[model samples]
Target chain A: MKKVAIFGLPLAFFLLAAVFLMRGLYSNPAERDSTLIGQPLPPFQLVDVMDEAIQYRNDALTGEVNLINVWGTWCQTCAVELPFLTQLKDQGVNVVGLYHELDSDPAFGVKSVDVIRTEITEMLKTLGNPYRFNMLDEGRRYSLDLGVTGAPETFLIDKSGKVRLHHIGDLNQRVWQSKFARLYSELESE
Target chain B: MNFRSFLIILFGIILYSVSHSASSVEEKFSFEDESKRALFIELGNELRCPKCQNQNIADSNAVVAKDITAKVYELVKDGKSKDEIISYMKLRYGDFVHYEPPITPLTLWLWLLPLIFILFGCVFMFLLSKKKQVDISQEQLQKADEWLDTK
Candidate 1:
């Protein structure tokens, strides 16, 4: 009995470890949910990229269901996801774009905010604007406030201004159909 | 140690110092208050970079880490207390952003399991060593010899 107790403990520990490892292997690293879910959206006031005179505040997400997408011209995945975002817009999903920092005009090799915004505007024009308006994230302070780690992420804000979901990759039909579509419907009816 | 081994250790020390000095040369935030600057540095060290999971925000060059360090500096300058800044970070980036995770019901076992396992191991080893070196009685030894002879 003593011998059994001695060896069994270690065996059980190894089994538990194996189970955890197997679960880790099967899970998607990107699917890890953000802790900000169920919390209110972080406060920020950023300028609209197209019109510097206009500012989009954090309150814009209140009283409505909206999808806030983080994107940048340099991110290739964001370009691929643009079409899906447009489709979501067509389906009547309110989409707001948050432009991640471009800091300097890459083409001109100078630190001109206007030139950088113009380049982003041109890029969006060439592709298509799914968002109501793309807000410029200067110095990425707004992104930091939102705990955004990188571009090509999206947040779902519900009617009451609470952040419902934070998806950490390019949004697509598969993601929408599998998760966000049902989630949106549930939140919309609330 | 041999001369070659001594030379290798010296070389390693030089390499480490060079890397350490390189990081020190990176631009640091300046503050009007020395204590605020110190607090900013402390906060940076305490916070982990969400993008580069293992690297502290102070040492990481990742964009996210840079942004976090900047925020920490700003908050310190704003006269936010250490606890408030930590809570603010926890709210935005979750428990993973800070080095110290709160002991919640879900995480209580995580915090306690190592100590529990160490206690169990110590007890097991103590019992094992005791059993191995236990003194045998003369009568028991005689009985064992007689039993062996009969076998």
Candidate 2:
């Protein structure tokens, strides 16, 4: 009985606690707050992947309604959505990208360098470098500021540099049709 | 309680059960070889379910992964090699499909952590065991002296 109480009870408590913690993380934020929507974009500088001497920063784009896609060459989901994002951009949707955690080796997970390089090259060939000026932040400082936890997350920053809309994961043709239309209407109203 | 009546009642129950059929949408794929099925599951457990992004295919609730697994069951039942199926999946979904993704220079830490932890645990356990196995010579001598005095 003593052993059961000592071992079983704590084990049950730990399991319950873990379940709750995961539940909380998965849940959306209770309140809808977009304080950053109208605020100036954060200052950041990153080395260009194409050239070592070329550095890109947010200072270059002072005021433009741009889409900053948080993506990585190593992410499979990012590759899945890359073509759609390019299509949207081709349709004249103002879009830029913060190549989150590029340049440096991925911190977690196991992926062969040869495979990753091949995938990235393929991605570049298809996407045709979507960013007006792409920047790579290995530490993910900018991504965290926008509350991005995953890749293929898209942030729509209006002319004022405030994040207007945040979309997570692959934006299919159907989703882009509706979402981008709404973005356009919102811009016209302003 | 009568034999004739009891048989009639049993037949009626059977007819009712047969009428209220459970038509499952689930596809039936049976395997003759136990080892192949086990291997499929072992391979399944090593692949991440694309729909349930965070979980291994075998551990996910995603119906897509379940469908893929059912397909794998069918193909394996039809006698496909393990390497062939794994390569097929990798081709379709990239290297992220592998649950324990191959350790590359970038992913060195994933492989290194377990080794480091085991080494640390061994050293810790060794020190703990040494501490536990104390020399009883002093305690025995003192107890013996006390016993002699009491006598």
Candidate 3:
């Protein structure tokens, strides 16, 4: 038994190290459990993207299950996911666009509201509009509050406005089915 | 161009670029007080950029980093303490936002594993030396002495 242990111990450690490294090779560095999961949506009162007259509060997202998609016209992935998001919207999923404006920074020269509206209208017209109504995250303050790192992130908010899931990449059918669909139904049932 | 002049030009360009990039971050965030400015800089160094892994928020030019920096400046101006600001960030972005990870059950292994490895290595080395000592008996030593005398 001592001889077996002497021979086997280093081999066991070698195997463990090999397994650990192998798992690291496949593990995604960008993927992390969101701290905001199980937390309610951050309070914000922002105007609509197209119409400044209409304002949306955090309470607007309550009373229904919704997907708050953080997207910008400048983001390529957002355009790619637009059709799929529209499909989800068509299927009765409450899809809300949290419009993340890239040029909102005054130092970098801010775009006029009319110019932004025109751009959004053009983009949404070309690609199918998924959003019931897009909330303009003015100066990206709301996105910061939501811990949004970049565009094409989605937050799955339940009926009570609690964020159930925060997906960092573009939303598609596979991701929806695998990540969002079951939890969505579960939240609906609740 | 001559080699010496070309080298000088290259060095000048590098210096200019470095100074230019440094000025960009400096001009963006400013505080009325020196302490607030110091706190802002410290927090920026401690906060990890969520978009770009392996870079602190101060070092990254990512939009998210800029947003966080802006927020940090706002909080500092509001008289929020460093711990309060860090916890506020942690609340939204998780422990990954900060450079110093919290000691938790899962992360405790990171600190413990290295110590455990050292302890095992020390034990193994001690046992190896003990085995060597045991293998060389007094009889073997006397035999070696006798053999040397005979030689």
The true-versus-predicted C-alpha distance at residue B68 of model 2, in Å, is 34
TM-score of each: 0.79, 0.42, 0.88
Error of 2 at A41 (Å): 1.7
- Model 1 sits at an interface RMSD, in angstroms, of 1.6
Which of 2 and 3 is the better model by TM-score?
3
What is each candidate's fraction of native interface contacts (fnat)?
0.77, 0.00, 0.92
DockQ of 2: 0.01
Which is better, 1 or 3, measured by TM-score? 3
Top candidate (TM-score): 3
Docking class of 2: incorrect
Which candidate's DockQ is highest? 3
Candidates sorted on lDDT, descending: 3, 1, 2
Global CA lDDT computed for model 1: 0.84
**Which tens-of-lDDT digit does each residue in B1-151 have in candidate 2?**
9999999999999987766543221224445678886887787787777555678767775543654566567668778888787766664444556666766897898789799989977997998788766755788989989999999
Q: After superposition, how far is residue A88 of candidate 1 from its true place, in Å?
A: 1.4
Candidate 1 Cα errors over 4 Å, as ranges: A1-7, A28-32, A105-111, B1-28, B122-138, B141-151
Evaluated at residue A63, the lDDT of candidate 1 is 85
Q: For residues A101-164, write the lDDT of model 3, one tens digit per residue.
A: 8766585557887787788899999999999999988889888888899999999999999999
In order of DockQ, best first, we have 3, 1, 2
Scored by lDDT, model 2 comes in at 0.66
